[model samples]
Target: MKVIVTDEISEKGLELLQKDPRIEMDVRLGLSKPELYEAIGAYDAIITRSGTQVDAELLSHATNLKMVARAGVGIDNVDVAAASEKGIIVVNAPFGNTNSAAEHTMAILLSLCRNVPGANSSLKSGEWQRAPFTGYELKHKTLGVIGLGKVGGRVARRARSFEMDVVVYDPYISEKRATDFGTRLVDLDELVQIADVITVHTPLNDETRDLITAEHFAKMKDGVLIVNCARGGIINEEAMLNALNSGKVVGAAFDVWSEEPPQGDVIRQLIEHPRMIVTPHLGANTFEAQTNVAVDVSKEILNLLDGRPVENAVNIPRFDPDLMAQMGPFMELARVLGDFISQLAPENPGKVSFQYNGKLAAYDCMPITVAGLAALLDRCTDQEVNMVNANLVADRRGLVVEQGRSTESEFFSNLITL
Candidate 1:
């Protein structure tokens, strides 16, 4: 097996791939488009960060490519559907940057509270300033976290250590789960009104776009400090600027922007605001994060080569020829059942049970189970969910998957239920 590294990864990661005698690895960074197009045809697998674009055009040239692994969480650079159609597996390291991102969120929040950027700029110009940089203490303050996923959960724990009260507004998580993390569960309206400092850690989508707008700012406590280390557009940029100008919000910190390396007049205005502290999306830039992601992606690549069940595959199923032929019509039916059930059920379903009856019970139903799960989950996440990683995705979401087979069905010869 041959693997190509299209981006710079930790040496430790390369060593792991080299350890396998059956694998041959190549490090080829900064390849021109034509060169990459040609080079990818010979390799069985490729690993990249965010630099390469694995689009349909490029995938067309990758005749021998079996898999593509991303060293980080996001797969925006990869055309997942195109890869999936070609039977190529796409995987990412979702856990690699959890700690680094959480720490960066804390760093941004602290910097905003103490006016660290302003203080540093003043001192560099040979001015002594002390009282102007007065900062708020974290103790006894209310910290509202929007999402309690990996990064947000870590931030919540850190806030508790600082003696700050933590409140969370995640519709997906239960109140008991929030309490387990030393945080209180509250609604969005309540969180916005009661929180002294607000941090957002949710994914950007149709629902979360402009999540915090002018009206939300109006509901916030006076002099509220806000931090967004998640995605951009979650906190409406125009609203944030207006709030900063009106003194409704004392200060705000942002790692991700509505537009990365934002160039528009509104983004420029926010950048020029003294009270707004920003970074060039540096939430996952730590050295540890890079190493962790590299090691993770490398292990996944090795798993693919070894025929092991990969955990983070972001594309469709790869079934044996005979299995695919036998499971054709059932796969379509299973997909419909998944889609229908998912829409009718709650947003974040914790458990999904599947029942197969009659002739279906006698044959291997694993493929059908996976197909249903993939269809159900494809709508919920940014990542592509497929039969290859359906159960893994369910497990990661803390969902219990139960399936049963029965020889009895009143109406149909084979009945599948969810």
Candidate 2:
């Protein structure tokens, strides 16, 4: 199998790929759109970072492509829907940069609290200004962390070592998990009201977009320090500027911006502000993180080539071994029926009905129904829909789904209705 690394990947990962005799690898860096289109057809797998756009037009030319591996967490740069339609599996290394991002968050937070950047500038200018750069101690301070996932959990643990109180907000995580992390679970309002420092670590989605708006900022404690190492646009830029000016927020550090390479008026002001600490999206810039992500993506590509299942696959179904074989044939039939139904139905499907006929009716049909649901809605949903939560996605979209099975005899041994 042939694999192409179209962007800059770590040397460690490249070494592993080179040692694998079953795979042939190529590195094509900084290629133009036309150059990439011309070169992509020969490879079975393509590995990339944010620079490459895996869109419909590009996938059209990739006749031999089976998998696309992204070296980072976010899949925003790749057109996942387009790739899925062409039967391409997309995978990403979501956990590889967890430590790197958490470390960067702490780095920025510490720098802002201690006024490191200003002090460094003053010393370089041959000035001894110790009194002006007085820093605050992190001990006894309240650290509020949003989204208590991998990176957030790590930050909370590290903060506790400094004798700081950690509070977290994540509705999805269980109470047991938060207790295990030794963080006080609280609502967003309470966190804002009590926290001395606030840090965000949530993915950008419809519910989380502008999560920290004007009202939320108003609720924050006066002189609160804010940090965002997650996605841009989670905090409203205009509202943040207003809070900064009003003294509601004392200092801010942002590694990600709503518009990358920030160009607007508010972004320019934030970048120029002396009290604001900003980086060019370097949360995952550490060498260790890069190597981890590259190695993870490489392994995923190799797995796809060998016709084995991938653990971090973003577009494929994750199934149990015993059940996978039993339901394998039904999945194909479901896919064909789903495709046919979707084309024949209206622009928006209000409901989907699944009916099972013949001797196969005695078996549990929930998994089959979900598999069919995934196929029908795979091309429509923004997020990846698998058999695990296909029904939930359908429910979220206000689509009613019904399932029924019968033991009546039919021409075929089993029949599935949609």
Candidate 3:
């Protein structure tokens, strides 16, 4: 199998792929759209970073492509739905940069609070201006965190060590989880109102595009500090600038932006503001982060090539072929039953019990049950649900699931009830 590297990755990752006898590798960086399109047909797999755009047009030319691996968490650069339609697996290293990003958040927050960048610049330029750089400490401050996922959770823990009170706003997480993290869970409105320093760690989506707007800033404590290291659009750039100018927000630090390499006056004004600290999206730029992602994507590609299960596959499912064949007909029936039952039954179901009778009961019907659950959840989530993760997903949603089989039949040769 041939693999192409369209963007730069750690040399260690390339070596891992090279060590595999069945694979041949090529490194082709900085390819224009046309050139990349022309070069993709020869490779079975391709690994890329955010620099490469794996769009429909590029996928169309990739006749031989089996999988596209992203070296980092975000797959925004790749058209996942398009790849899914073409039966191509797209995977990303979601956990590889958790520490790096979390650390960067702390780094930026500290730098902004203390005016480290400004003071360093002044001293280097032969000036002693300590009075202008006076800043407050994190101790005894309330730190509000949004989207308590991997990076956000880590940030909360680190903030606790600095003697800061942490409040989290993540609807997805349970109260128990918040307690374990030593954070008090609150609604967005409450978090905004109470927090002395607020940092966002949510993905960019329609619901979160303008999450922190003028109104949100208006509700915040005077001279509240803000930090965003997750995505660009989660915080409104215009609203933040307004807050900064009015002294409602003392300082803001951001690693990502609404527009990378942003243009226009608003972005320029934010950059020029003395209280605002900006980095060139360097949250995941550490050497360890780069290597971790490289190793992760490399292992995922190797697993795919060797027909092994990939836990992080975003576009497809993995199933045992022998089991799939046996349960193929029952799988469809199970799905229909689940769909029909879900529509007729009450909302917010607590448990699902499956009973199989007749000759079909003699076979291992676990795969059939999984298929049914997948179909049931397919209606609820935008994610691709499959037999592998169906039960896992159900558990996460707090649904109880069980299955039983018997050779006895009531009316027909076989009976299945959900």
C-alpha TM-score for every candidate: 0.75, 0.78, 0.78
lDDT of 3 by residue, 1-418 (tens): 9999988899875678889898898999999999998999999999999889999999999888878999988777888877765557798998999999999999999999999999999999999889999998999999999999999999999999999999999989999999999999999999999999999998777688999999999999999999999988799999988999999999999988877777868878888898899998899998999999998988888888786556577765434556555556677898898878777766667898999999989887776787688788767666655554577668777889988989989788888789
Off by over 4 Å in 3: 317-418
Clash totals in order: 0, 0, 0
Backbone clash pairs for candidate 2 read: none
Q: Over the full model, what C-alpha lDDT does candidate 3 score relative to the true structure?
A: 0.87
Query: Once model 2 is optimally superposed onto the true structure by TM-score, how far is the C-alpha of residue 95 displaced, in angstroms?
Result: 1.6
* lDDT per residue (tens digit) for residues 102-219 in model 2: 9999999999999999999999999999998998889999999999988999999999988999999998988889889989899999999999999999888778889999998988
lDDT of 1 by residue, 1-418 (tens): 9999998788875678888899899999899999999889999999998778899999999988888999888676788877876667898888999899999999999998888988999999999989999999999999999999999999999999999999999999998999999999999999999999999988777788899999999999999999999888999999999999999999999888877669888898988898999898889888889889988888888877776556677665444546556666787899898988888889888899989998878876877888898889888877667675676778779989888998888999988989
User: What's the true lDDT of residue 305 in model 3?
Assistant: 79
If the candidates were sorted by their lDDT against the true structure, best first, what order would they fall in? Answer: 1, 3, 2
* Full-model lDDT for every candidate: 0.87, 0.86, 0.87
- Which stretches of candidate 1 lie above 4 Å from their native place? 32-34, 316-368, 371-418
